[model samples]
Structure formats: structure tokens, C-alpha cells
Target: MDHRFEIFLACAPGLEAALASEAKGMGFGPLRPMAGGIAFDGTWRDVWRANLVLRGPARVLARIGGFPAVHLAQLDKRARRFAWGDVLRADQPVRVEATSLRSRIYHEGAIRGRIERAITEELGSPVADDGVRLLVRIEENLVSFSIDTSGGPLHRRGFKQAVGKAPMRETLAALFLRECGYRGTEPVLDPMCGSGTFVIEAAEIACGLAPGRARKFDFERLSGFDPQAWAQMKADAAPHPCDLRFYGSDRDAGAVRMATANAERAGVDHLARFECRSATAIERPDGPAGLVMINPPYGERIGKPGPLYGLHRDVGAALMERFRGWRVGVITTEAGLARATGLPFLPAGRPVAHGSLRVRLYQTGPL
Candidate 1:
């Protein structure tokens, strides 16, 4: 049954426009950008396609219902009215998380308690902490419940078993790559390649690999979901080849090792080379110039931005000196630090929330 499903796409703030554009390109109809996410109407299969293809969205949520309720009794009654058994198994565990925005349920803990109580009392199932089989999101007095079709956030592509400090998220990495217009036709480089997210994402894109092919999803546990159909979908979507190669380098040996391990696990080790080298020692790949994207460290937590200024300066100078005719994109938290790069960055784009800090993207081409 191709039932009506609401898909919520979580994204970095200020990137909703870009994410919406990408959804349009992918033939998703009429994307409406909301606070913290975007909503689109589609079927369960569309959710599968989204998790497989969308690079900008952090997580694609299927919003099942948004019924309004003013009190706990009403909420429980409404929750019990829905067809939870159709999606959740009786023996498995599930988790429900709720948030209140201008609603009577002010305390999140209290709201969680009510939902848990209702589910267990009405549905006769105990919640499991570790082996959580389902995830539901209740928002703004509207209980927009959903099952996590993609297991453990799509960014945990299962390939990155190892990583460096301050490594960029794979989802954000792919989004930045798209923003930089990286089609993977030309060689791509990440000079300060902590855990090699950028280069690895580029390699996967170039080779036409499905990012979610290696992992399992929560939808696989649902009652109506077809395992054979999912397997067939994955089998139909295998990797293909392209001309461009991916490369990354880092000054820290530990980071290079992690990058190597991550690339190897992703099954694209043959298409990438990770080396231990500083930004100053960077050189163009064997082929023609392509995109150069960097996510440099910002010492915001230590409350010191001086050293980062010099690092950005050094990166900018090295790019100017060696990477002529190359397109460059840099993501950083501090505005002054990005200016220190001294590249002809067009007016800065809106800052997007990255974990705890807000980061902005700056792009420029070598003159």
C-alpha cells in the first residue's frame, strides 16, 4: 500500500535552500522548508530513494501524524488511536522523543514520560534502551511520529570505523562537495584531510556508489516492509566507474591512518590515496585541476582564534601559490579567520549550525 507519508529532511541551518534545490533536481515534488528541516510528501519507497540519494539532508524522517493535543490524557488517547502495530513489532523495542514549542508540555522529560507510559500501558510493550527498534518525533503539539528508515543516521555509512579529531560529518561533506560543484570529472584534493571525508565522498560520487548500500535500516524491522524488495533495490543500485580520482593529505600520521582505514572500508580505496603531509606541502594531482575543499580547525572551545587565523592564512597562501585555476571551498566557524585566508571569497553565505558552532562556507577560484 503506497500510503501517504510525510518525509522530514534534517539539514544544517541556512542550507535549506540548497537542500530544497537538490530535492527538486532529484524530482521530489514541492519541498517546503521549515525550521531545522524540510517536509515532502511521498511513499515508503520514496523515503528509501531519499536516504540513498540525498547528500544535503542529515536525516530523512517520515512524519506519520501531526494531531493536536492539549493534555496528557488526550495525547495518550490519540497515540493509542493510531495504527502503531502496523509499523512496530510487538516483541521489539521502540523509543519516543518529544519537544514542545509554545505548548503546555514544557518539560521534555515529562512529555517523554507520558508517551512512554501510554505506549507501554496501551500497547503492552516495554521500551528498550540499547536495542531501540523504532524512533518517533513529536513536535509543536503535533505528534509527527516516524520510524527511522535509515539506521543510525545515514552519515554513519558504516565505512568510517575510524576517524580523526574534528572530522566533518559524511552528510555535510557530501553537501559541501555538491555546493562546490564537484561532479568528480576532475581530480579532487583535501589538503587538511582529517579522516578524509571530502575526498572519500567525492570518490563515491565519481564511482556512482550508493552511500547507504552497505548499511541496514530500521524499516527492515517493520511489519509491512519487504526485505526481498529492499535487497533487489540495493542490487539494482551498484557502483559504476568514472574518470576522476580522489586524494587527501594530513600533517598528522594518525589522521592519515584513519583516512586510509575509512577509505578502505568504503570500498573505494582503489580510487583514492591518503598521505601524511601538511597543507604547505600540498600539490595538484597528476591530472587537471578540480575542486579543493577544506574544513580547517577553529579553536572556539578554547576561546582562542589567533592560531586559527594563521592556519587560514597559510592555507590561503599555499592555494594561491600552487593551485592556480583551481576552485576552492572552505568551511570555518569564525568569519575573521576565513578572511585571513585572503582568497577573493564572494560575500559570505549564511552561517549554518554545525554541532555546537555555526559554520559558513566560502568559495573562490584561483586567479
Candidate 2:
């Protein structure tokens, strides 16, 4: 049964427009953009497709059901009345979490206990740590539930076993690429590619490879999951030929090796090339003009030493001198470090949450 429900595609702060565009490109919409995500209508099959194809969203949550509850008694009664067999199984464990805001049931612990008892009593199942997660939210005296269908964060992508310090996530890389107006038609170069995230993502896009193709998900453990249909979906995602090759250059030879190995693991090594060279030595590639994207250290992930400014300046000088007609994107935590590039960046975007520090995407038009 293709029962329709709300699916929220959550993303990093300040990049909802880009994620919406990606969904629209994939033929999903009239979407509503919220504070941290986009909400749309879909069924289990749509959920599966979303988990399989989309690259920008960090998590895919299915809003299943909810009701108004002014007190714990009402919450317990309504929770027990809901049929858990339709969604969860009785043989396995299920994890329940809750949050509350502007509601009478403000205590999260009490809310969790009531819901847990209701589920255990109704479904005859135990609540364990590693069980299927059910998020219960009490907002304004109403309780709602959502299933984290993706299990782990979507950025894992089941590849890139090796990484350097302060590495960029695959989901963020894909969204940043979209925010920079990239559609995978031309080449892409990452001068500071730590593990070749941008280059590999670009290559996969150009070849039409699904990001979640190689990964497993939590939805498979739920009831009514059709293994045969999911297999067919994965089998149908055929990769197209991409003549354009993506490039990544790093001063660390170890980073170069790690990137090459990661590309191979991601099945895009043939279309991606990694070079162990300084950023100042990186020149524009042959053929069509494309993008120059980099995430340089600005004391956020590592120390912001004095030479960091010189490194940005030298990289900026190299791109300015060698790469004419190419656009650029630099992600940094501080505006001063971005200014050190001296590139004509467009107005800065809102600060994005990158671990402890928030960073912004500094983009430029064709130079």
C-alpha cells in the first residue's frame, strides 16, 4: 500500500533553497521550506526513492501520525489506541524519543515513559537502545511521531573509509555544489580536496549515480517492506557515461593517496583524478570552464596560523592568474580569511553549522 504521509528532508541551516531546488530537479514539489528542512507529501515508495537518490538532505523523516493530548492520561490512551502492528513488529525492539515545547506535558522523561508503556503494552515489544527509533514530539499540547527512515545520517554514503582532519561531509558538499549553481555538466576542481569529496560527488552526478545506492537503511526493518521492489529500484539506477573528468589537488601526498582510494571505493575513480601538489601550483584544466571549489582551514577545524592567510592569498593569486572564466567557491568560518583570497566573491551566505564552528559559502561569478 502506498500510504501518503509527510516526509521532511532536513538539511544544514541557511541552505533550504538549494535543497528545495534539488528536490524540484528530482521531480518532487510543491514543497514547504521550514526552519531546518523541506516538507512534502509521499508514500513508502517515495520515501525509499528519496533515501536512494537525494544527496543534500542529512536525514529523511516520515511524519506518521499524531493527536492532541492535554495531559499524560490522554497521551497514554491515544498512544495505546494507535495500531503499532501497521508500522512496527512485535518480535523486535523499538526505541522511542520525545521532545516538548509550549505544552502541558513538558517533562520529556514522563512523556517517554508513557509512550513506551503504551507501545510495550499494545505491541508486546521491548524498548531497547539499538532498536528502530520513533521520534515523539509534543508541541503545543499535541503529540506527533516521525520515523527516522535513513537510520544514520545520509552523509555517510557507505564509502570513503579514510579521511583527513576537518573533512567536509558528502551531504554538505552536494548542497554547496548546488548552491554554487553546478549541475554536473562541466568539470570541477577542488584545490584543497582532503579526501576528494567534491571531485567524487561531481563525477557521480555527471554519471547519474545515486548517492545511497551502496548503503543500507532503517526502513528495510519496518513492516510491509518489499525487498524485491527495493532491489529493482537499485538495479534500475544505471550510471551514464561522463566524458568530463573531475580533479583534486592537495599538498599532502597522504591525502592524495587517501582520495584516490576513496574514489575507487565510491566507484568514480575512473572519472576523478587526484594530484599531490601545492594549491599555488594548481592550474586550470583543459576543455570547458567550470568551478573551483575549496574548503580551506581558517582556524575553525585546526589552528588558524599566520601562514593560513598567506596560503589563501597564494591560492587566490594562482586561481586569478591561471584560471580565467572559471567560477570559485570558498568555505571558511571567518570573513577576514575569505577576504584574504582577494577574489570577487558575491555577498556572503548565512553561516552554516560545521561541527563546532559555523561557516559560510563564499561564491563568485565567472572570473
Candidate 3:
């Protein structure tokens, strides 16, 4: 058998284009950008590589099989005949989740129960609510089945035990770096580095380190897994020596400690430096100009927005006065706060759904 499968790279709603660009640069083939993700055709090896290398996708899913089922009876019958043994193992417990849209089989709970029973009865596997997830989507009378190849969200990265109040996810930080035209050749600075996400990600990218190197994936437990191939793939990761250094700073002492420990855990502590300093106190280091990215508190869940205006203004002043040739990327939830900075910002991107509030990335040319 060819063992080729259709794969979906899930990302934040507004970041599909950035993820597609990164995927294409990494050599994933036959790709199409969708509403919330990117779709592509690849084999098992490709699946493993994607989970190992992709930095922007929240998760990687493999479309296993599908069929047209208008009602419960047809769904049960078709699901029973599907090749369950091809992907799932009899010893591993599984979880089935279903969503219906514009289909006669509209009850999500009933659809999940039928698929769960079918897999258990046919494949002799146990069903658990928290086990590996198998997603079923019914749309316009067509049912599609996919397996969550990535166990947890890729942002976990198996590092950073401690986090700040509104820490940015590693995947989003990587995409933001790319959006700011960062190609891993120059240094990066994060004035409000919550848990050091941006700084660590920049160091990893510059060193050519794989994001999933320290983590495990759900695909390792599948029946089609090849240990020898996986070992070879992991061994092929080539980490290069980087001359550029990354920096992060925060006023909270505990946050600075967390960032330092996280950088140490990520094995990039030598290249990344963290400090406890207010944003306005940040000074440009002695080097060529690079990118300065910050995800400051947007007052959505924290303090009031009035005081943040001055904070943003002070940050803008520090950047404009000290770092004259560097570009800036600011992620905030309000346009007024960005405008308060008084920095000459270019046009903002679409609002991205981050938690309950929508956020946007405002960029600036060299100051």
C-alpha cells in the first residue's frame, strides 16, 4: 500500500497564510490554504516530519477515511465496514468526536456513540473520553474521519514549566517572527517577554533546532508506526552554530526567573538572555539592528487600559530613541493602545482570536 494520506495543519484562524508559506518553504507538497488550516497530500514519513518540523500549526491531523451517511443506520453500517485496523491499534484506547453541519445525521452525541461502538466492536479496542482523538465531521451528507496525529497542541513543546499571566504560545510567536520578516540571521528582542516565548523561539530557529525534538506525538502509538524510520528522521536534525543572540526583559522578577529557567530547559540559554527591567528602561544592545517583538498586556484581563496607554507610549519612546534602525512588531488587542504608542505603524493585520478577545499585530519599519 502507498500509505499516503491527506493532512491538515491547524493554526490560528487568521494565520493560515503564514502557515502555508512556512509549509511550502519546508517542502510540504500539494498544499492548499483553507479557512482555518492548510491541506496537503503526504505519506506516513511526511506526517512524522510535519509534526516534527512545523512551527506554526497547533496540531497535525491525518484524514483516514470517509463516506456518505444520511442517517444513523447508514452511518453505523458504513463505519463498521471502514478499515479501523489500518490506523488504530487494538491495545490503545481511543476517543471519538463528531460534528454535524447541514446533514441529516445532525445529532453529535448519537454520531459519536455509533462510531465509538463500531470501532470497539470491529477492532476490539477500548473507548475512553480522554484517549487519542478521532475526529468525525459530517457536512452536506458526507462524513469525513481523521486522527489527531499530534497528541497535544504543538505549542506545548515539552518545555517551559512556568508561564506568565498572558503568555504567548510558541507557535504563534514563531509565526509572528516570520511575519516580521525575521529569517533567523539577526538578533531578536522582546521587551515584555512573558515566559520568554519569542526569545526562545528565535534562538531555536536560528540554531536549526526542531520544535518537537523534546516532545512525543500521538502518531507514535499508531499501528503503522516505524521505529527505524523515526529514529533516522530524528538523527538527521542538524543544529547549526548561530552567532546572533536573543534577548527578553520583564519588570516582574518572578517572570524573569521563569524565562531564564525556560531558556535553560530549551538548551538555548547560552544564546538567549533574560532580565528584569521595565519596558521603558530597555536599551539597545551593541549589535546590528534586528527585530523587536512584544506581546504586552492588552488590559483585556489585567489592569485598566488608561495606564497602559502611557506604558505603550513609553515603550515607543524607548524604541524610537535607542533602537533607531530596528523594526518593531507589537501584538495588542486594541488599536487605540497601538496608536497610543505614537510609533509610525504600517497597516494592521486581521484580528486573530486569542482566548476570548481578538488581537492584531501592528508592525513598524526601521525607526
Candidate 4:
């Protein structure tokens, strides 16, 4: 059998273009950008490679099989006939989740129960409350089934355990870096480096390290998984020499320590350095000009707007006075806060949903 399946690369909102670009560069075929992600078609091996190598996507989902079912009885009948044995092991546990939109089968609970019973009865697999998740989407009377190839989101690289207030996810940080024109050649510095996400990601890119190298994925537990092939694929990762170093500084001493330890666990401590310093006190490192990216505190998560304006003003003053010829990328929720920075910012990107609020990246060519 071909075993080629439709794959969806999930990412944060407003980052579909960047994720699509990364997927294209990695040689994924026939890419199409949708509302929240990118869709493509490939075999099981492509799924493994995407989870292992792609840096920007939040997760990888494989559309295993689907059929038209307008009612619960039809859905149950169709679900039983799905080729579950090809992908899921009978001895393993699985969970089924469903969502309905503008379709006749609008009862999600009934949909979940029917599919769950069908899989259990047909495949002889035990149903668990929490394990490998099978997603079912019913829209306009058409039902589709997909499996989460990534158990947890891809952002959990399994390295950093400690996080500061309002930590930026690794996947989001990677996309933001790409948006700022970072190609792993130049140095990157995060002034408010909560958990050292940006710096460590940049260093890993500079050293040519696979983002999923030190982590485990849900695909390993699926059927037809070849351990030897996966071992060879992971072993092919060769770390290159990085001439430039990445830097991160935070005012909190504990955050600095956590960032350092996280970098050590990521195996890029040699290329990244962490220190404790406020944003206004930060100085440019002794090297060629690179990118300065910061995910500072905003009103949504941190203090009120009044004090934050001064903080933004101070950060702008420090950068404008000391760091010349360097590019800047600031992520914030309020345009007023970004305006407080007084730096000559070019057009801002689309607002992305981050937790409960929307944020955007304000960029500048050179300061």
C-alpha cells in the first residue's frame, strides 16, 4: 500500500506563511495554507520527519481516513469499517474526540461515544480516557478522522522545565525569529529572555541541531514504526560550528539561572550565554550587529499601562543610544505600548491569538 496520507501542520494564528515557508524549505510537497495551518500530502516517513525537524509548527496531524456521515448511525457504521489496524495497534489504548460544525450530527457527545464503541468493538483496542487522541471533525454533514502525530504540542521539546512569568513558547519564538529575518547566521539577543526561548532556539538553528532531537514523539507508539529507520534518521543530524553566539539577559536572577540550565539541557550552552540584567542596563555584545528581539511585559499579563510605558520608553532609549545598526523585533499586545518605544517601527504584522489576548510583532530594519 502507498500509505500516503494528508498531513496538517498546525501553528499559531498569523504564522501560516512562515510555517509554510519552513515546510517548503524542508521539501514538503504541494503546500497549501489554510486558516490556522498548512496542509500537505506525504507518507508516514514525512510525518516522522516533520515532527523531528520542523521548528515552527505547533503540532503535526495525519488525516488517517474519513467518509460522509450525516447521522450518528451512519457515523458508527463508517467508523467500524475504518482501517484502524493499519495505524493503531489493537493492544494499545486510544481516545476519540469529536467536533461538529454546521452539520446534521451536532451532538458531540453522541458522536464521541459512537466512534469510541466502534473502534473498541472492531479493532479490539482498549479505550482510555487519556492517551493517543483521534480527532473527528464533522462539518457540513462530512466527517473526517485524524490522529495527533505529536502527543503533546511540538513546543514541549522536553528540555526546559522551569519557566518564568508569561514564557513564550518555543514554536512561537522560532516563527517570530524567522519573521525577523533570522537565518541562523547572525547573533540573536532577547532582553527579557523568559526561559531563554529565543536565544536557545537561535543557537540550535545556528548549530544545525534538530528541534526534536532530544525529545520523544507520539508516532513511536503507532503501528508500523521502524525503530532502526528512526535511529538512522536521528543519527544523521550533524551539528555545525557556529561562529556567532546568542545572548539572553533578564532582571530576575532566578530566571537567568533557569535559562542557563535550560540551555545546558538543550546541548547548546556552548553557543548561548545568559546573564542577569535589566533591559535598560543591557549593552550590546562585542560582535557584528545582529537582531534584538524582546517579548516584554504587557498589560494583559503584567503591570498596568502606566508603568509599562516608562519601561518601554527606557528600553527604546537604551537600544537607540547604545545599539546602532541592529534590527529589532518587539512582541506586544498594545500598539500604544509599541508606540511608547519611540523606535522607528515599520508596519506591524497580523495580530496572533496568544492565550486570551492578541499580540503582534513590530519590526524595524536597522536602528
Candidate 5:
């Protein structure tokens, strides 16, 4: 069994450096930040720990091996000869997906069929729609293989069951927090806290809690996996107590209730609190100034940014008036909408693809 593996952490396109920054902080690399993700070389244990602890990646992939295959016959012969039993179970069904990029083998369907046949005939594994996904990429006659080790997605975190409109994904929230210089030391407040993603993530970081502690991963089904070892690894994640409290405020009472419930499910209810209040009605908490991060509605979700100018103005006014000394981060799709806040937002990060629309993080220095 080759224990050495190349780990890839997939995040939003514009968030490569932010995720790399986190990977660096956690000592996960000598890191390499790529287009849509970052990769590091480590043991399988590092793969498990990355799955458990890293908060900014949508999913984790383990690159197994590759070979130069200029044709479908070559691909089939090599994929079958390539090690399968070392990682994949013979009895378990698997899904084969392939992409051909500037390669002699241009037919992706044929590539998938060949690899699928190889797995079934040689490895005795059936190809099924809902099985573990094996990604095959053939670029310029070189084929590479990677397993989707993190499962459905790391952002699921298995805690946040409640989500409001245009809710931010947990991975994006974590990267945006890092972009705003949040390191779990101070408090975080989201006036437009959609389902409390930021608040719960911040609280977990503060309390030294693993983001994946409450979730199950797809890697558990892989061959050569040691349940006892993984259990012991999870058991070692003892959370350290933190006194700082994460706060969230929303105008809707239902949103407040949802946020509170999410925090409770995340086991950080003791460190997080949600209140029913509008941005203009929010007052500064009686503690040291921290970070105020908000992902307000940016027309892509609810409506146009034309009607949102006043809302942005009010939020900016509220921060400038009462919440002096706190830094701020505003995420939105429209540059005009972000500027409408009237706060002194500095240069923003590159636009991140939230969904069909690209969003940017507008930040400001301490007020």
C-alpha cells in the first residue's frame, strides 16, 4: 500500500490564496495554490486530518496515480494494471468520470467506459451511479486519477440545517473570514446573518473545535481504512474553552431562531448568540471591537440593488455611528451596491464565484 498521497483542497476560484493561507496556518503544506484549489503532498493520515480540520475547502481529493495513455485501449490496460485493491474495495460499486483536455483521446465517454470495464473485470467492482466518484483527467496524452475523499462536501459540516435566502456556503464564509483577518481571537457579528454560518464557523474556530467533528465523510468507506485509528483521531479533537462570544443579528425573528438553532447544533451555542434586530437598530456590544462581516442581498437573489441602496446606506450609517473601531467586510455582487454602503471600503479581493454570479469581499480598516 502506497501511503503517500497528494491532497487537493477544492475551494472557490478566487479564494485560492485564502485557502492556501489557512493551509499554511495549519501547517498542512509547503503549499501550492492552483486555479480552483490547492494541493499538498502527505500521508493518508494527513488526508484524514485535512478532511477533519480544514474549514475552507468544498471537498478534499486524494490523487492516487497516473500514466500516459494516448488511446482508449492504453487507458483500459493501464487503469486495470494500476493499483485498485489498495484503496477501493472489490465488492463496492464505483463511479468513473473522465475529462479529456488537449489529448489524443478526445472521447470522454469511451475513456469512462474503458476505465469502468477495467474496474469491473479486473478489480471486480461494479460501476454504479451512486458509488464513490473517481475523477479521471487526460491532458495532452497523460491521464491522472484522483478519488473524491471528502465525500458530499466539506461545507455541509453536518450542522447547519437552516438556511435563509442567498445563504453563504460554510467554505466561502471561512475563506472570507480569513480574508478579513479573523483568526478566532475576537468576536464576529453579521447583521444580515443568513442561517448563522459565519457566527458558527467563528465560534468553532475560537473554541478550537474541528469543523468536521459532527459530520461523516466518504473516506470512511475506502479500503485499508482503520476505523479505530480514525475514531482515535477524532477523539483527540478536544475543544479548548474560549471566552469571546460570536454574535449575529437579523431583522426577522424567524432568522434569529434559525441562527440560534444552528449554533446549538454546532455545539457552539455557549459561544455564539443571535438576536432579532435590524442593522440600524444594532448597538455595539460591550466588548473590544472585532470584525463585522455581512453578506447582504445583492440583487442576484432577492431583487435589484436599486432598492438596496438605502439599506446599504443604513448599514453603513449604523456602523459609522455606533460601531466605531470595528473592521468590516461586505460581500455582494454589485460594486455599486458595495459602494452604496458609504463606508470607507478599501481595495476588495478578486470576485469569487458564489453561484451563477460572482461576488467580491469589500473590506475596511478599523472605524
Candidate 6:
């Protein structure tokens, strides 16, 4: 009998609706938007595809159990009584992370400690900081439990060995690509590409490659996991050459070098082109019109906010002069900086958390 799996794609705040739409467009059934994630139901095949094909998910969680509890004793009783042996191994190290909101049991540390003691003392398993399974929780007078199935988050693609200063995250880069309507068919240009994450991801997406293909997942180590099935699935999802569709340039030679090295590690060096050039030199290749997405320096990450406005204005000037007919997407937290660009803003979605600051994606026409 196939088990019922509750899959969640954890996302930045205010972006759950966009991700839900993307999932639905991809034929993912019964997608429900939650606080900071989108929940769906699927088998292991769906899990594999989500980690592979999803562009906006920060991490994926598999819900294990949810039950009501009014007091700490009830919490301990129900948590211990839940089927812990079914998912976690006696020898596997594990950690418990808990969050509480409007709950009778308001102490987070106390909750974590009790749950940890229950699993350790009763189950004969010890808490491990590294190289072990993880138990996550959301307690609001009721408890919801999940086993982290993605291991060390999905962004650690095991390919980015080198990164430039203020590098963009792989997960965020993928989401930005999707926001710009990048189908991976035409060339993608990241004029201020830091570490070439966008270019490498675009190449992989176009070639129909799985993002987690080169990495290990925690589910593989879980009890009753089918090794043969996983092997077959991975083998079937291997990368193949389809088209050359990625390019990135940075004025910083160090960033260019880092991007080049990262692309090589990702095994898509042949599918991308990297150079140490300014955004003014960006040009489209001989193909159908494509997308140009950029995340320029915002005040939060770089210099004083005073100079950032002009920098944004300069960036806008460059894009307008250079990229006349291409779809463009820009991410930033400062409204002033965005206005300085003078680009006609079309809101793709709401603000998303990029680190601590809330940011939004501003898009413009095919010109």
C-alpha cells in the first residue's frame, strides 16, 4: 500500500501565492497555500520532481503528524505516543526544532527539550547536531510535526564551490528566473551575475536536469527507502544537451572567475558563457527574444542608501538603452531605488524575504 505523503515547499514570505500558481501550472494537484509555504499531496515521485523542477521552493518538508494538545503533559504524551519508530532510526541522530504561537505551552526550549527526551530516552536514540535526521514542529495549542526530507536545504546543490561577494542564493535565483518567465528556451542574461548561479541554473533547467541529481537527500537514509527505485529515478533524470541558453557578466573580475568556476563544477560550462564586463556590454544572441534578470546592489547589502538611488537610475538607463525588446525582472527592497529606475513597473507578485529585508520583484515589457 502506498503511504499518504504531505509535501510542503517552504518559501519566502508573501510569495506562497506565486509558488502555488507555478505549481498548479506545472500540473501539481491540490496545491494549498499556507503561511510561508504551499502544501500538496504526492508520492515519492512527486517529491523527487518538486526538488528537481521547482524554482521557488526554499526547502521541502514531509509532514509526519499533527495532533491537538492543550498542555505540556498532553504534548509530551501525544508526541511520545506518535509513531516515531516508523520514520526515525534508533541509531540515527536527530534534532527537534519547535515554534509556538498562542499556545498553552509557550516555552519553545521546554517543548524542544521534552520532545528530545521522549525520543532519546524512550526510543533509545540520541540527539545529533550533524549527520542525523531532524524533527520540525509548529505548535499552536496543537502540534504539527515533520521530518526534514531535503537534508541540508535544497539550495546547497553541491556544485557551487566558489562564490563571489554578496552572491545570490540558488533558490532565490531560480525563483527570479521563473518570475521573468524564463522557460529556459532562449538565452538568459545576468549582467550583474554574481557567481553565475542564475546562468548555471538556467542551463540545467533547459536541459531537463534535476537540481538534486548530484546531491544526497535525508530520505535516502530513512528506514524502508527503496534504493533501486531511487537509482532508476536518478538515472532517468540525467542531464542532456539541448541548447546553449545562458550568459552572465560582472565588472568584478573576481565575480566572473567565481561564476566560471561554479559553472564548471555544475558540469554546464559548455552551456554558459561568463565574462568580466559591465552591464552596458550586455547583448542578446542570435535567437528568439529572451529574458534578462538582475539583482543589483541594494543598500542593505552595499553602500549608503544615498548613492544607491543613482546607481539604480544608471542601471535603468543601461537596460532601457541596451535591452529594448527583452523581458526584464529586477529585485530590490528600496522603493526609492525602484522608482529611480524609471522602468514601468508591473507587479509579478508580493514582497518576499531576502534575508531580513522584505523585497519585491518589479518587471517590465518585451522592450
TM-score of each: 0.91, 0.98, 0.98, 0.98, 0.98, 0.92
Candidate 6 weakest lDDT stretch, 10 residues: 131-140
- In model 2, where is the ten-residue run with the lowest total lDDT? 298-307
- Model 3 C-alpha lDDT per residue in residues 139-232, reported as the tens digit of each score: 9999999999998999999888999897788999899888888879999999999899999999999999999998989999898798888888
Evaluation by TM-score, superior candidate among 4 and 6: 4
lDDT for predicted candidate 6 compared with the true structure: 0.79
Candidate 1 residue pairs that clash: none
Better of 4 and 6 by lDDT: 4
Per-candidate local distance difference test: 0.78, 0.91, 0.92, 0.91, 0.89, 0.79
Model 3 residue 5 distance off true place after TM-score fit, in angstroms:
2.2
TM-score for candidate 4: 0.98
**What residue runs in model 5 are displaced by over 4 Å at the alpha carbon?**
none
* Two-way TM-score contest, 1 vs 5, winner: 5
- Candidate 4 per-residue lDDT, tens place, 1-108, comes to 257889999998899998988899889979988989999999999999999999999999999988999888899888889888898888778998999999999999
lDDT of 2 by residue, 262-317 (tens): 99999999999999998899978898899999998887587755779988899899
lDDT of 1 by residue, 1-367 (tens): 3997778888887877777777887788677889877888998888888887776777777766557877777877777777777666666667766667777656767767776776677666677774443444445666566666665777888898887676789988877777777766777899989888999999998887888888877766655777777778788778787767788999989999999999999888998898998887898777788889888888863336777788788889988888898889989887888889889897777788877888889988654
Which ranges of candidate 2 are over 4 A from the true structure? none
Is 3 or 6 the stronger prediction by TM-score?
3
The clash numbers for all candidates, in the given order, read: 0, 0, 0, 0, 0, 2
Worst 10 residues of 3 by lDDT: 1-10
Residue pairs with colliding backbones in model 3 are: none
Model 6 segments more than 4 A misplaced: 25-27, 131-133, 136-140
lDDT by residue (1-367, candidate 5, tens digit) is 3467788999989999999999898889989888899999988888888999899999999998999988777888888898888888887789999999999999989999998988889889888887889999999999999999887888898888988887889999999999999999999998888699999999999888998887887788789888999999899987898999889999988889989999999899988889998877888888999999998887777778688999998989999999889999999888998888899999989989997889999999999
- Indicate the residue-level lDDT of 319 in model 1: 89
Overall local distance difference test of candidate 3: 0.92
lDDT of 4: 0.91
Q: Output the lDDT of residue 88, model 3.
A: 93
| lDDT value, residue 81 of candidate 1 | 77
